[model samples]
Target: MSDRHFSHEVWLSKLRDHLTEERYAARTSRQCIAVARHFLRCLDKQKVDVSTAQPASVEAYLQQTRRMYRRRHGHPTDYKGWQCLHTNGIHMLLRLVQGLWPPAPKAVTPVEILQSEMRGEYAQWMAGQRGLAPGTVSHRCCEAGRLLDWLGERATREELATLTHLDVDGYLKYRAAAVGRRSLKDVTTKIRSFLRWLYMTERTSRDLSSTVIAPMLYAFESIPSALRSGDVEKILAATRQDCTQKGIRDYAILMLISKYGIRSGEIATLRLDDVDWRQEVIRIRHSKTGAISYLPLLPEVGEAVLKYLQDSRPKTSFREIFIRACAPYRPFRCGSSLYRLVRHRLEAANVITTGKRGPHAFRHARAVSMLRATVSVKDIGDLLGHRAADSTLVYLKLATEDLRAVALEIPTGVKA
Candidate 1:
């Protein structure tokens, strides 16, 4: 494409036409317009006449707009709608600029091009080769995308080849500030995995494996204490009183959480076949590790699940164990439904808590109960289908007194 200056109106019109012709989602089109308008405003402020500006100038304009957006709205805590605005906006601006600039020889590093190709290949590998759950693949792809975005203008193949440990360190530090240490660790790990794949493919010479570190073992200090027994009773009672199918479904979901310690995501993805009455187990498919596992169903949990399934569950083609009780019924899309279910129950029960009342609290409560019952940590890990014993060790902290009781007695008076 040849570089040609277009008026702001002309560019905006083109963007609109492109968006309309592409039949982009309403939300996407709105965001594209927002981004285009912001780009125009930036050009006006910089006194860079669009007609006179070169392709490089257009690139600079995009960077300036990104800085302005960050300054105005601040770095997003979560990559929800607003964050989408800034990122998608920049992408749209790039398209608009490229349209005007036509074809130009853009300098790019071999490493950067390889990384791009590797990312696509890796995503496909994850989905097709690894047979990973969709959510798992999505998460890994998101992490890779974030790292590439952070690379920004420096994402050239040559730059990647010359990347130092300090560059990785800086990336981690940026992530720590942007989100948290845990998130930084997650993204870093994903990047490291991608880099490892590239190395095996002979894309680069450096191993750099030693530089990658797993995220620190942050304690589960945030888990809320179990609600009082009375509050639990009240929540249960409130659930029983409501005659609606939704009420029954919510009640049963909460019961499963309180009794079995199932993760909300697992519960959301539950299927009719997951419940085996004869075996007295509930199969949890596509759990956190993308593996299926089973939990022995307690009588109460089994009864509640049966009640919900038989009388309350909406009739739908969705094979999910749980479905929305509302009209045009749909299966629960995410764990957030379970969270909302628990939150509503908490409010109804008049239970007050300092932090968020999510479905995970019930999981914590069950862990505590098991710990208090003198269940071994290893066994607990097995029951929870934890890949590592350390994953279930958080219950140890919550069960401080129990651990104290089981502590080996040391002879204090005699010195070894």
Candidate 2:
């Protein structure tokens, strides 16, 4: 067959060969082939000659194909789904066209050019221009990519320019319904940040950042009284005298939570230098507020931690206070470790576990106990390293009696 009249099977075979030769994963190759086949079938249904297809023809074919697919599938054909079906088909098509007609000087469309340019520019700006934290940059890039993916098989920069507040709202609502509230909130925040970047960089004419703000859920007054002091005491007592490395580490973690109201993340990030034996204070660095605060070391908490550090903690070069107890032991890198430790202890103690009873529960418990003891809200906020007094005020919910005392009193036996 002439190159211009290459059959559907021939083009598909070439596409499959390209995917395999590029070392695409097995699943990816299958998906790419599927998308290519679909696109070719779409061309056939439109009676378009694939061999004579130009860039404009390709664009028109994609639009008609999307409408057809939506009519058949009852939903618009999303670019992500199409891309997944034939991984990087657009990029491959561009390359293939250039290769087949080297001297032709293939026409470059604005949308195609913009997508390519924006991707590289956004990545570079996120890394060097914004100097965002590595994790933050990664998250924002992923979110932006998702938005592009939603634009479907022929997304363009102009379409992005035309996006309205309603579009953003719909996207957020779709995400919330698809995933969960927390994930929706996270992705929305990332999108908002990206929009801000776009506005600052003059990528868009109008600022769309104001259209998307994560709604405030409720304020946390105190840790939910998920488990009572009795239950916590029981869990700790069960660990008494076990003396295993895991047990020692867990006990120490629990003690700190109960006594200091220290966040699990704070405990995981604790360093050797954080403890000041002379001053009896533990400095918590890089807390949620990105500020450091010191808490006086209680004798019980200090002793528990010292015991674990010396006796149970695996010897490692890691500067963090805690480390994994198992083989190939590594420093405790995040709050999840502390949560697992608490969970295991709770299971061992036979306490019925409930909503997120990680090390933070101990923090909540401490805050509630302190409030019950009439500790000032300001002092509680300081101790907890909370930047705002309102954050600490959540403990008032736990202190029902305190609130009741200040409420208006009823007159004795007055008839209505």
Candidate 3:
């Protein structure tokens, strides 16, 4: 980017083209170009050459923009959405010209810097030494980060030697108030792992891990959540009707979940090459059991995904099939992002269910549908990638109505 390009109108044409590719409305594009023109005029008056302008100078111009416009620009639909759009429009231009839009990360304190370094080390140890899966490592690291955050200034390695059992108990007690019993138990487990690592590395004077105990758990305590027979269809129908970019991507995702009962992580991690158009099948790698299954590509699903890939998906170099529908386009951040997407779609479609409500709900729902269709238990196990036959049996617990049909009549001689 020549400084002259910024000062000149050469990049304005490029900015307009970029906005059009991103699906910006004609009105919004005009507003953006107008803002860019105004900005260049201001820079000219200030005797600041546009070609050689500093980022700080551009930031100053953006800062003064707030003074020119009022809070409510009288937009009826979005209610203050214009303010955000204006900022975003100008940012788009800056990103187009400079490429490094944000410039740099926010400054961090010494304690914070050390905290991040230790977390990275812990993640590496979990993956390299323990050979844990990526998902397990990520979850454990997040829990450990929580403990370190609670410790605040005392989180550094040298301070580990100064820690005591009271700190462990206090942290657990603090966490207990916010999470369910199962989550608290997981937190305790996460803490013990971190403490053990510290002791093994000789950072801690003693094994404080022995002091951390897990909470009790009951067997078969809660029912697994699932959507009704029609709920999944409702969500799919609603999403399928939406031809927007995000809708197209989300519809493809819902198709995978509903049709094959694959886990969200599998969908998020699915690469473009995973789909075999000639073979008419999609490859699914189980996120939990690490098993791989090839499912036949139903025409409906293949068509939906094909439409998204061709029409709406942003042009990105990511091998992942599903990309986010916004600027700074990227793949979903893993299962949790997909979970949020599914949950929102479920809620928006006015579908409700009790118990666990993430992508697992869709998986369980698929299982129930299979059961209702008289799918053999072995077939269910095979489709869902369950290593243990007993795992497939768990879904039978949710088929209360189907089970009732198979109940044998009790003999009169038998006692209640």
- Candidate 1 C-alpha lDDT tens digits along 1-416: 22323466677777777776655667777877877677666667777765455556556765665676678888723436645665555455555656544454443676556556756787888889779777777788877667777887665565666766777777777777777666666777777876675566555567665587667755675545555445666788888788788888888888877776778888888888888899898887647776777778889878877888888886667788788765336778888767778988898878887655888767777788788888888877776768888688766777767678779888889776
Candidate 1 Cα lDDT to native: 0.71
Each model's lDDT comes to 0.71, 0.73, 0.83
**Which one wins on TM-score?**
3
Query: Model 3: per-residue lDDT, tens digit, 125-214?
Result: 999999998878999998888888899989777787888999999999999999999988888888999999989988789999999978
Better of 1 and 3 by TM-score: 3
Give the per-residue lDDT digits (tens) of candidate 2, residues 318-363: 7888888763356777777666678888888988856666777777
Which candidate would rank higher by TM-score, 1 or 2?
Answer: 2
Candidate 1 matches the true fold with a TM-score of 0.61
lDDT of 2 at 188: 78
> How should the candidates be ordered by lDDT, best one leading?
3, 2, 1
Error of 2 at 229 (Å): 1.8
Model 1 alpha-carbon miss at residue 286, Å: 7.1
Off by over 4 Å in 2: 1-120, 123-132, 178-186, 199-206, 213-226, 404-416
